[model samples]
Target: MRPKPVKPKGGQESVWDYPRPPKLEEVTKTIEVYFNGVLLVRSARTYRVLETSHPPVYYIPQDDVAMEYLVPSDRTTYCEWKGRGRYFSVQVGDRMEQDAAWYYSDPIGRFGPIKNYLAFYAHKMDKCLVDGEVVTPQPGNFYGGWITKDVVGPFKGVEGSFGW
Candidate 1:
């Protein structure tokens, strides 16, 4: 059963109102990722994916990410709406996060803008920011959504909500 939708406050958007298949769109707001006391990514040119019961997932342009810190990983996954996905391990200084990032090299038409763009697991990073505001990672190890004040949710990926 679907959880009761949270009423949005102020300018906040309810995740329950997001579409099922998800919507991908360009975001001009700054997106940043920090780990191991180093700034790994900061970009205003990025894409965001919004889906039902989930927060937005920001995809940073490959050019904005520190590629030297990203080592390709053998792990792979699939998203029915986006197509194949591949994981990457991020290393900065002596610290490393395995399979902490992912991207789609060849996404379906609707998701084409995100091709080759990287999305990180916010919880795995020291900090992830959207529009200068710190983000809260969507609960659970499998989903990579980044929750911010602008979005409201009783989001999926929380304990006992796996079937959502």
Candidate 2:
């Protein structure tokens, strides 16, 4: 027998209501990264994409990320909302922050949760600005919420973290 389809809670719009980040409207823009005055990553073609239930994730081409500064970590976690996530680190001038970036390359039943979104550690990023606003960056070591001063959040990343 077929069960009833689950409906969106609170009569709210489901994640599918909006286009996913990678599939969102794209703009050929410039993105840059700096750590203690040293240019880490700077490039054009930076994309302002979405991660659905998560947040807007910036998808910079591989060329834009300083691979030299990124160290892969084995820390992995499941989102139930975004799928399994993998971690990475960034180093800058003798400073290293652990697990600063994360991505879910292959999400499960991806309706809108992060499928291929790459987010950096706002706290570790010495300087990260989007279209000229110095992004405030999100908090916590495992979540990826870009919470600038004005932009607030109870972002999906941290919604269920207390159990972890």
Candidate 3:
């Protein structure tokens, strides 16, 4: 059964209202990721993917991320809207989160702007922030969308929400 969506208040956006195929929009606000007290990424220019039933996933440019901390992983996944994704393992000191980040080397025509950009799993990182506001990780293991204040939903990615 599909869960009823929560009513959005205070100018919030409902994930249920987002498009199925998803749309890419450039983010002008600051996007930051930190792990083990170290800054992994900080960028003013990023792109956000908004899809139905999911919070936005911000994709950071390769130049803005701490590339040394990311190691290429053999894992890969396919997204109907995007293309095949390549994974990356994040390492800070001795701690490592395998396949914690992903990027599409060659995206579909509509998602071409995000090609080669990286999006991290919020739960795997110590913290992720948008414009200084800490973000909540979207539930479940497979989806990597980040929840911020402006977005509202009974979002997908939680237990019992798989069919959404």
Name the best candidate (by TM-score): 1
- Expressed as tens digits, the lDDT of each residue in 13-62 for candidate 3 is 99999997899999999999998878999999999999999999999999
lDDT of 1: 0.93
Ranking, TM-score, top scorer first: 1, 3, 2
Model 2 residue 39 CA deviation in Å? 2.3
lDDT, candidates in the order shown: 0.93, 0.57, 0.93
TM-score of each: 0.98, 0.61, 0.97
Residue 82 of model 3: what lDDT? 96
Residue 139 lDDT in candidate 1: 92
Single out the weakest 10-residue window by summed lDDT for candidate 2: 13-22
Regions more than 4 Å wrong, model 3: none
Give candidate 1 misplaced runs (Cα > 4 Å): none
Using lDDT as the yardstick, the better of models 2 and 3 is 3
